[model samples]
Target: MSKDRLISLDVFRGLTILFMTIVNNPGSWSTVYPPLLHSEWHGCTPTDLVFPFFIFIMGVAISFAMPTKSYDNTTFNKIVTRSLRMICLGIFFNFFGKIQLFGLEGIPLVIGRLLITAIVGYALMGNFNAKLKTYLAVSIFIIYLILAYSGIKSYEIVRLPGVLQRIGIVYFIASLLYLKTNQRTQLLVAVGILFGYWALLTLVPAPGFEITNLEKGTNLAAWVDSVLLKGHMWEVTKTWDPEGILSTIPAIAEGIIGVLIGQLLNNAKLIRSQKATQMLIAGIILIVLGQIWNIIFPINKALWTSSYVLYTTGLATLTLSVLYYCIDIADYKKGTKLFLIWGVNPMIVFFLSEIIPQAMVMISFPNPKIATGQINLLDYLYVAGVQPFFSNPMNASLVFALLYVSIWSVMLAYFYKKKMYFKV
Candidate 1:
């Protein structure tokens, strides 16, 4: 481990990414374990913590990244550029296979498009001339727009709000707050946002609804999404989006909480043990407060409720505190490398996790056992290769998910060995 870096943070991030990959890519979604699946309506599940954890981790990263720097045009540009790239990547993932090009729309088209975009994206991220990078960005945007509205598919209905998009926006806002405001101000803003969001949801009625409620589609957050994002909302529930506009207020608070924790962690005046102790105490307090608030607001992940933010941030803080004590403070270094590899280069691994499965599902081959006389590559691998050995469907699905994660782990290990970390 490097003297400059926190082994525990890397491990925590890697663990989150690993679990996120497994949660997202089950062999069969129908057979997933209850803990792996998100809660149906209100309440927190293990799966619900993954995203907020990542966001929290991002804030921690910002604390380490920005404190050494003097805020100037260059710093501002870097922040904006990184955030925009992440949001663009999120948009690209949402609309990956929707655009048709040269009479191609499946696996081949996806591969080609991904390759071209990767090249352009790489160039934009490279140490290229400012004018050239801007030109490349504009060119890609124009091409993407042309393809989106070319009438091949109804681009109007493509979902806009997504996980990465939310991350990007929150990161931008939180980064600015961290740069400009004092620690006291940051904490105050986080508290105000949380309480303000709670009040807005519980007190004010949505435009179309007469009552203030936390019901699925009738809630203020969902209603705001329905009006603002109309055709661009999530497909599963057109009337609402899990990553909606209003809900993001609480998400920002979540990020600010992360920033505050990061500030605590970054404080050199405090020793590792002190930091760990403080984090544990803070985590417990937040968790208790979240539960108390949940009595009225409810800890709903879909809504990104204020209570949900407090609860998950509490859990994250507790987890990190333990990791810090064991790994960083005590110097117990055994078995830390497994997660370190995945943690170091999370953005690329996550992006690959999304596109690889899509490409796999698009490629089909003959399979006599199926009604269609063919099956996609992913299903065939799961059905023929893994399912036959296990008696239980859920076990088989889980094994397949593990297998998928294991394959990526191997790839990430190689990347780690080569020191080839790709940042967004």
Candidate 2:
């Protein structure tokens, strides 16, 4: 490993990406295994931890990726540009295959925008003129706004923000915090956000609903989403989204925890064994505290409760500790290449994973097995090739999801061989 690069960190990130891809691309959502599916509400599950874990990992990355110089105009501009590109790319992914121009449909405008944004953001490698880079990034954001506006079907306005958009927003906030604050202040700020969010949820009644309960579409968060987002919430739940406004406050805490972990790892005074022990001890304390807190606050992923943050952050800390011990401290580097591949180009792989599935779902084909009507390509393939082998639909569904992950792993491995580490 390079002096700056941590092998364990890469492996952890890669494994997180791997599982995220699997849970997201399950063959049949309806038949998914309990562990892979998010809890209905007010509870944490394996799947519930994935999104926060990614955010936490990003936070850890900030310690490594953040500019070393004093914050200045150039640094601010770079931060804004990178954040804009991420959010714009997110908007593009959400509208992929749905863009229409001059009454023409399926233009792949989203993908095109993504490519342009990637080029401006990553391929140039900060080599281009700063003003030009800013202009290109701003222009991409404008085009995304126009396309997103055009794609909206409802006249009610207010639109659903994409998952990537939410992640970008939290990322921007967390990164700014990192740039501005010392470790002590960062920890205080993170803790404040979590508790402050909890207080607001517990004390303030939902507008018109006149209750402070955490029920779906009835809580303060959902009410905020309904009024602010209007027609823009998740399609499945038009009234509210899991990644809505209020929940993200606590999400920032996850990122802060990651930053702390990164700092811990970077502390040269501490030996490798000491670092692992410290992390493990901290994790245990947080887990216990979270469980106790859950009695009142409740560990809910959808809500992104303070208790949930504590629990997930605790788990993530422990996870990184184990990986660090095995990979970095023990010098046992066997069989980590698979994860390294995805880790090096995480967003690229994740973006493709998301968009490719949507594209597959959009292309319709005649399903001979269906007797008469047409089915989308994904369903057609599932029916003909995957669904018949097992009596349990869930098992077959899981198999299909694993296959999707395996395919991506192979593609990423090839990219790894070529050393194509696409980043922004």
Candidate 3:
């Protein structure tokens, strides 16, 4: 099988990339869809589902794209080379994507840490005894305790858990799992992890773990986060470390779901009509399961609760099915050029936006408001230009979001025409 139908995967990926652009870059933070706002702590939101869905879908793509257990040395080398390139790109995106080198101390330390991390990761990424990997993971947790409570207050960058790091770690383990375990066992692990997190939060008492608020520094997750990672890192949530240790469990599930998705898509034996029906039914089941789980567990983006995973996975599947139906079955792909562009180079678009915000922000001019001389540029723009036109902040934010996507959409359109796919 070719393992790729550009329309379905790109459309689905494009959908995700579009939301990423929209959610990340609204005209004003104050305005957004109700679904867009992350549930404070114990609940779920549409916005919360976005990142996991994206990563999960990435996993799906990986399954389709990656070679199976059998491979020649040349092919293996190619896989290694590509994986290495991706790891580097992901790290670069982590370090320089959103940061500016201000002075001597930060730059040198950043370089020093990257060197150390590379050495450590290089040493770390070989065939270890299975139990040893488990032990190392456990030991890493213990060391995290020592660092957090050891009272050696130092802001070393690598000490923190970040989006790329979490992805790296989780994906590494996930690859091993895929190699070593059966589907049933992997599913059980995911279940255990989610419940384990729940038990920790509910049973293990922090000073005020029971109380859920936006103050990430004190929450149960934050306590673990503060203990495990101590630097600036927020990929999942703005207030909390988006890729917190507690949340990685569900994130892995996202990848596993992708495995299933890939299985469905890759099994070319199934007729297109059969695949569409199966996907639709599977998506519906997930949505139902997510809703039911929400009653007890609460679908939370920050938490990456199992229910949220199920719900988002379902929605993602359904969305993919629809795209497949339209583009392939119905043969109707009139205006998907823009999204296809962004879709092909989603990671590049993301990292470029993060790194090149200076040039990218020209799409919308900043309108600074003098609120007793304390002005916020982002909010001011929304108030002056967006708010006057749209009554609600959500509408204004949505408009800005559309424009933001449109800017990238246009760039992608040109990239699409030029056949420019900036792959990592």
What's the TM-score of every candidate structure?
A: 0.95, 0.91, 0.72
- Writing each residue's lDDT as its tens digit, candidate 1 over 1-424 gives 3467778899999999999999999989899999999999898889999999999999887898876647898788777767766776677776765655678766678677678557755854555665555555556556655655555455767777889889989999999999999999999999999999999999999887788999999889988898888877889989999999999889999899889998999998998889999999999999999999999989999999999999999999999999999999999979989999988889887776887888788788788696669888999999989999999999999999999999999999998898887776
* Top TM-score prediction, candidate number: 1
Each prediction's Cα RMSD? 2.1, 2.9, 7.6
Show where candidate 1 strays beyond 4 Å: 1-3, 105-107, 120-154
Tens-digit lDDT track for model 2 on 174-255? 7888888888999999889988998998999998866688888888999888887776677788988888888888998888
Per-residue lDDT over 128-216 for candidate 3, one digit per residue giving the tens place of the 0 to 100 score: 55445444444544454454355443423423444545555555555556555666787787677666766765566655456543334
**Candidate number with the higher lDDT (2 or 3):** 2
The better-scoring model by TM-score among 2 and 3 is 2
Give me the candidate number with maximum lDDT: 1
Q: What's the lDDT for all of these models?
A: 0.85, 0.79, 0.63
> Model 3, residue 322: displacement in angstroms?
2.4
Candidate 2's displacement at residue 323, Å, is: 0.5
lDDT of 3 at 230: 54
Clash-forming residue pairs, model 2? 159-232, 160-232
